[model samples]
Target: MSSAQQEEEVLGKAYDGRLMGRLLAYVRPYRWQVVVATLAAGLHSVTQVVGPYLNKVIIDRYLFPTHAPGSHSLIGNYLPADPWRGIASVALLYITMLVIGFALDFLQTWSMQWVGQHSMYDLRRDLFHHLQRLQISFFDRNPVGRMVTRVTNDVEMINDMISSALVAFFDDSFVLLLIIVVMFRFNWKLSLITLAVLPFMILATRAFRRAVRDSYRRIRVAVARINVFLQEHVTGMSVVQAFNREQRAYDEFDQINRVHLRAWTDAVFAYALYYPAIEFLSTLAIALILWFGGLRVLNHT
Candidate 1:
């Protein structure tokens, strides 16, 4: 590995609030887009909660009419006596919510993409400008490939985090919270039972993330090594041919290629393990919901 690659092997903290705050500095100029994205996400979250609720209402009020319009009925006085009318009304609202949610989600996605592209453009321009001002010694110490990767790969990763991961994280959190709230509001006991697997799922997800991260880190190192090898070899191809060292160069390249392949294999293994684990956990959760929530349905609880 190059000295630059070795230096990058030092794994730092995954999150740094101050670093994130600094990143937001770039978005400050495009606050309007952020605001619109936030609004769209917020609207989307509300629809996520409300849409499911409409289905629940359909099941409880229209399909079964558990408690027919009577003195004890909660909405008997306000809603139409005909259950079909009530179902149609709620279904209309559900469709409306779905349409709005789709539009808002699309808007948020497009807006974030725009923000990411623009922000990265500025960031890369500034990065190149700063690199131009750096001392010659710094360039001498770092491989040209590593420097180029900083401008392209590393910056692109950061842009993805900012535009996609960060925003989605917040929106998903809100949607999850809303789901939990709605679930408990509908049936506290059933919600509690369904949520029992959450801790185990969380643990499994954390383990998966750690494993994949380590594997991908190895892959990055391997890829960087490959990049450095290619850059140096291509740049010095004449020197090797002059010395009649083609066989030696080929052997070295073969060795480096194998290392890169092994790293990629490890990453693929991690990915293969993670996704099935997630699918299994998801199926397990569904099974649990059916087993327990089915009991609630039978008992009319």
Candidate 2:
């Protein structure tokens, strides 16, 4: 059997409190940067609604007669007759918001990435130090290939979660919360109807997460097997030739490669199913909005 077929020792959990606490400990040193990045993400989240809300204000005031005269306005007074100045001012403010959001997004990305890189660097260094302190029997028990994976691929996965996924998680969460706030703020009935699809979406997401996790695990195992097979075969090439085992070695490698291909294909299928599923649900939401929300607009309710 290929090394990739070996049983994995590090099993991941859906929600591991101890694991999360340890991860947070690694991030504690850079808590200030994390805070600033979060604040910037929040600013970007709040600013995201500005353009749409501004459009609503402009349409209600200048384009449509949805409200009475002298209602809420960005300027001193909102006169339906004199909407040009108000419209121009609102547009300018909208443009300003876009600019500010751009700056905030840049800062947020940079700050989080900085924190992530530094934290991962420390983690990688620690991993290397720990490996250096291991006994010779440890080396004899574990293959060189598996040890290499520990210091490289596995560490890279942790780095990705710490540096990219963690920040992205917050960014996405804030965006979702802001979307809920904006949807209800604009139209509660439409929002409720649109959100009716959320429970299904969440369920689909949960299934996708579990499936993807298994697929990814299979992929990692397959990759490790291939790496171990290659490393051992290449190092023992002379012995294989002396024993006329080239054909056998080639066959084994082909088998390992096929297993790797199958593993990655499963991952691809998981991704394919998840994204299109989300898009289908999103389309359903939009269809509901157009059907019901359209009626509300037409009836002027």
- Which 10 successive residues of model 2 have the least lDDT summed? 1-10
Model 2: lDDT equals: 0.81
Give candidate 2's TM-score.
0.90
Best by TM-score: 2
Instruction: Write model 1 residue lDDT over 88-168, tens digit each, in one string.
Output: 787787799999999999988888878888889888999999999999999889888777777887788889977898679
Candidate 2 clash pair list:
3-225, 4-225
CA lDDT of each candidate? 0.79, 0.81
lDDT (10s digit) by residue, model 2, range 57-79: 78877777455443354543543
lDDT minimum window of 10 residues, candidate 1 = 68-77
Stretches > 4 Å off in candidate 1: 68-87, 296-301
Highest-lDDT candidate: 2
Residue 26 lDDT in candidate 2: 80
